[model samples]
Target: MSSSTVSRNSLEADQQWLLRSSSPENDLDRDERPSKPRRHIVAVLCLVLMFTVAGYVTSSVLLNNRLEHPFRIPKLPHEEPCDFAPSRPSWNSMPRHRRHAFISAVQRLASKPSRLGLSNTSMYDDFVYVHTKVVWQVHHHAISLPFHRYFVHIFEQALQNDGGYDGLMPYWDWTQDSSDPLASIVWDPWAGFGSAGNGCISDGVFARVGKFANYTENGYEPHCVTRNCLAHADAVDESDGVMHSKHWTPAIVKAIIDDSTTYRDFRQRLEEGPHKHLHAYGIGGDMASASSPNGQFIPQPKHTLSRIP
Candidate 1:
């Protein structure tokens, strides 16, 4: 109750004091824990974050150079008065009967341009006349190819004589690329503006004369050429106006089929009649220059010859 009791009581008091000081009860205990950032450091971090965001936004803006749209180039126009040296024997140089026959034949073509052949069909009559005229003029040495202007005039006349044209004549729309410079002829039905050929290169009849016999204008043209003239179509099918030599009229073929004897005799007479004249009067090259292993006759020659300025 004296010395021992007093010593025990002092030890208990010292233990309690040590526990309270070490158990987060003193300021020194708080100092031992991690401290929060200073306001200045927080402000500096916020400023750096803001600057980084602003820089990203600025970089994004710079990367996208504002342009409304893309750029494009244009094409050039075509040259006129198509380049072709006129051959001998002016279209008018022929006798009146001969000229009338040729003219009549061409005029007739406009009315029945499409013809029955064994495997294909030709263009409609008016188009046929114009196209054939061009081909013949180019290939036939005794004929001169017409300029584009006179060709147009003859075309107009042909149409008028056939009871006036309601629409424009179909033209070879050579705007697109040509597969062969020497043997290619392109035509678009909707190539002209307004009335029939409006916005299209077709006028209900157009034939793609090449390795592929396609009718882009009307699916009927190729049929006519193929069905009636199988032999002629096959031999000179690939050739343009300058290559085809043999031309068979529907009447002739029909007559031949009807009566072989009469047909043969008539064909023989027809051949012999014009054989010498054509052979002797060509531009020094005979029909050979106009010949193609696989070709059609050159068209529009008389049109060229009619209006030589």
Candidate 2:
């Protein structure tokens, strides 16, 4: 009786072990089931985490761009031929207070740190940095006019957004003083650009600009606003006078406008004739070089917005 009972008990125990929850035979299937599901869950979690991080980064960049440039708003499809201001008024038309404001804005810009990190100079020198680097690339090509137009446009934007200048950039119509540029109001001491002495400009608001950055060769060099106004100096050209190009008379500029039929012809003539001549003419100061904006004779653009990309 005891042998039969013991044999039955052993058989029951073996069956119970086979059906146990932690048995190796059942564990094979359990392991296979969860392996694929766990792998899928981990991959999905990784993807979700990656997407979350990317979304946060993209949103942050967009927020920063909006904060930095509030004026840069996307135009709607219906907003065609956007025109805010019809005409650009010259500095002569600007009131005395506004003129002073422009000067103050420029001074404020010069006080700020350089954004380009190209030199220790102020933000104003950033234009000099760009203009100097792209001088050859922009100049002597069809892109010259548009490139310079871009310069004035960007510069004006910096002045407005950064320097807090509300007035439209001023354009100098130098043709008025083609006869005697030295006597021009553009060089007035108090309200206008102060005169020069000993070859370097010692007066005017721009007198603080004692250094300029040349990105092409040197980073920054100590320089001053100087004009080539040497009527009778040592080691000079006889043909050259107080001004560089006497050929840039009003008649010639008119001929370039009136005679040119094609766009290329017009641009070419304007760039070569009036443009180059004006730069090389009466006030051949820093305005004649890539560091033109750093000087008193800042060339303002009329229809430069159209040229910008």
Candidate 3:
């Protein structure tokens, strides 16, 4: 054969051999292979969705049981016996030393290392994390009151155990100050949750004191815990120190309680009505946000207010 014809034939043979020897992946392209990342993302998404659904179902069942039997917590034999005798007094009724100690405990807890998650955070910040995280799930539902009650109890235990507080779980009885919420002893600069703020508080125990959680895109960032005691939506109450106290008069709260014909109704009304106003109008800042509990720098007032009964 001629040299030109022979070279063309050899090139064709080499091309065929190369194609035959290559694997299917090499024939197509390595980049065209199925994406492991996409599969992993799908698996992770499925797991997240499964856990979320399970959590919701479990929460619903537990909340329903809580509704049916509000005080049916299972206790160990060695656990402290239930005592109904110790009266849960209002914040106003607590003595100076008790209030001071409780405040100290709260501060100590806030200052301590995180017990819930992330060693970088404080134990109190853990409360803020869960409170902010589950606000949507627990609030505006049957679990609202019960969940908060349990949360407060756990917080109180933490205070006693970690903070060395040996006093009753304090709470703010808003009814006393509902007519003039600002003047309520809970805001006492010397002994209470410190003074109010237009933006961030500038005076009192928590003055310029930063918190580990502040409702940011990044879950935990140390910032000043806010208490906007002057913020109000009502044009009339906009500048009033009492804020929207008119809507929360003792009679108004009584009516809210009395008018609620069903448990759900009562819960819904209380959650959406005075409970909301007290946080939004009565005290603004973080309380107005999804994480209402983090609004106060001084949790003693928040704790005191949380103990409804």
How do all models score by TM-score?
0.21, 0.64, 0.68
Model 3 steric clash pairs: 170-304, 171-304, 171-305, 172-304, 172-305
Residue 210 C-alpha lDDT in model 2 = 63
Q: Which candidate model has the greater lDDT, 1 or 2?
A: 2
Q: Please, what are the lDDT tens digits per residue for candidate 2 over residues 1-309?
A: 564454344333322432342235323332222344433443332222222311222444443434222122222224366667445456555676877887777777777777665446777776666555544344443445544564565666667777888876776555555566566666666676667322456677666566532332234665666644332112124454344334455676678668889656676566555555444333444544555555633443223223322
lDDT of 1 by residue, 145-197 (tens): 22234334444444434423333333221111122212222111222111111
* Model 3 steric clash total: 5
lDDT of 3 at 164: 92
Off by over 4 Å in 2: 1-80, 196-198, 208-218, 230-245, 300-309
lDDT of 1 at 159: 41
The C-alpha stretches of model 1 lying farther than 4 A from their native spots are 1-142, 147-152, 161-163, 166-170, 173-176, 179-223, 226-309
Name the lDDT value of residue 277 in candidate 3: 61
Model 1: per-residue Cα lDDT at residue 124? 27
lDDT string, candidate 3, 1-309, tens digits: 764454344333333433332335322222322244533443333222222321222444433433222223422223476666455557787888888887788788778776444557666666676665554444555555665665666666677777898866766667677656667787787778776645555666777465535443236666766655543422234433365666666786688767879767776567556665666555655665555556433443335424544
Full-model lDDT for every candidate: 0.27, 0.50, 0.56
| lDDT score, candidate 3, position 217 | 20
Model 3: worst 10 consecutive residues (lDDT sum): 47-56
State in Å the error of residue 250, model 1: 38
The lDDT, on a scale of 0 to 1, for candidate 3 is 0.56
